[model samples]
Target: MNRTIAIGDIHGGLKALIQLLKRIDLSPNDKLIFLGDYVDGWSDSANTITYLIELAKQNTCVFIRGNHDDLTEAWLRTGDLNEQWLQHGGQSSIDAYRNFTSEEIKEHLAFFKQMVNYYVDKENRLFVHAGFTNIRGVENEYHDTAFYWDRTLWEMALSLDDKIPTDHKFYPKRLLLFREIFIGHTPVTRIGEDKPVNMANVWNTDTGAAFKGKISAIEIKTKEIWQSDPVHELYPDEDGRN
Candidate 1:
């Protein structure tokens, strides 16, 4: 049978990314959904995109745009970036891209530009880089910000006690539109854990792969998880999103 795998933020951890794919043992028919933030930490931000471009040739891949990716794309277009962008490992991305040719830069920029904000599979499994403000859909609702930046949705879930009153549902009705929701912007590691944290009906897969934690990937149907070694271990010389 085919598996629908949702991956967490990469943050330019190419070693982790490669190890993750190996661990998944992707099948020909399986689909890989990347939760984004593929650049701006560790190293190989440029090479990581190049690898994904090649991988897409043999397997179905869904790339969602994350805030970091948006910043990178903006930098590529204007040839300038602000401190906010550069501070959060964005300088690494600039360094990575600096070695590319004009055509390579355009190709990578186009790749980032074409990334979708959110994706709803046939099973109604919503895959997004970050949380959404409202559940109506991301096409127009918070089109520019919510899809790749909102955290309140996940915050609401985390705020509630796991065991609610017998008659009360764990979450609001708005988030129930999808059978399941997967996101990657919020690192579970920062929440006092280094693994994917599931709350209510949403799963936060970002295990801080760009920082000291590992990159994570989960098979949506079975919830089977696979992880790469700690990113810091892979690139000891670099300062990851720390």
Candidate 2:
């Protein structure tokens, strides 16, 4: 059967990405939705972007922009580095592109530029890199950057009592807006989970491939999960954003 899969943050772990895909045994009909942060952590940022570009040609895919993607794109365009970005994972991305030609860099920039902030499908399922703040929903959001930067939505979901009925007046209006929300900015690993965590209707797929966790993917319909070995294990020679 055709499947719709939501994948977690990559953080340039090309090997993990490859492993996850192989385990999924992808079919032409399967739709792959990648929560971003495609770069900034591992050493294959440029190559990972190139692979995604090519992968799109062979299968259905949706790419959502992440905060890291935003930061990396800014550096690519201005050549100005953000100190915090470098310390976090930006240096790995920069070094990854050191061997690329100007034309190649341009291609990668175009790839980043084309990523969407969020995607809502026919099923009313929301796919985004991070949470949105607007109670009214993404279209009425006051800031576009919030799509890839906000963490309050997930935090709110986590703090919810879980006893509140959906129809209760105090229930979060934003949570009621979509059938489900899939995000990837806040790593589930931070909360002591190495797999996807579902709080209320929001599913956080960022299993922390950028740090010590493995990359993960969840089948939207089946809730079945597939994961790669810990990203740190895959790249034993390098410390990934640790």
Candidate 3:
């Protein structure tokens, strides 16, 4: 059977990504939906983007734009550094691209431009780098930034009572928009989970690979998970985003 897998934030941990993919034993028939933040954090940011671009050529892949991706694209296009972004993880990305040719930068910029803000499958599962604020649905979102920056949706899900019926008037209108929502952006490690966390109908896949955590992926239908060794272990010489 063809499987659909949702991957967590990578944050330029290409080694971890490679290991995770190997463990998954990828099939061309399977679909890989990446939750983004493809660049930043680790030392191989530029290399990670190159790897992903090539990976897409051999497999079914959906790339969602993450906040870091947006920031990196902006800097690559304008050469204007975002101080906050650099402090968080952007510096690594910039350094990684220092020796790249203008043509290569343009190619990578084009890839970033092609990323979608969010994707919904036939199964009514929502895949987004972060969360959408629209209570109505992603189509109705007024601010595009919310697609890659919003945390309220996940917060609401975490705050909910699992016993609350979907039909309950107090149940969030947003959660009703899809059968299930898979998100990245906010690391599950913040909640002490080194794996995906499901609350209400939202599943957070970010396992904090940017910091001292492993990269993760989940087969949506089977809920089977795969993870890499801790990203810190993969690149022990450097402090990731910590």
Q: Which stretches of candidate 2 lie over 4 Å from their true place?
A: none
> Is candidate 1 or 3 superior in lDDT?
3
Clashing residue pairs in candidate 1 (N, C-alpha, C atoms within 3 angstroms): none
Where is the poorest 10-residue window by lDDT in model 1?
A: 165-174
Q: Is candidate 1 or candidate 3 better by TM-score?
A: 3
Tens digit of per-residue lDDT, candidate 2, span 102-151: 99999988999899999999999999999898888999999999999999
117-142: candidate 3 lDDT, tens digit per residue: 99999999999988998788999999
TM-score of each: 0.95, 0.99, 0.99
Clashes of 1: 0
Steric clash pairs (candidate 2): none
Off by over 4 Å in 3: none
Local distance difference test values of all predictions, in order: 0.88, 0.94, 0.94
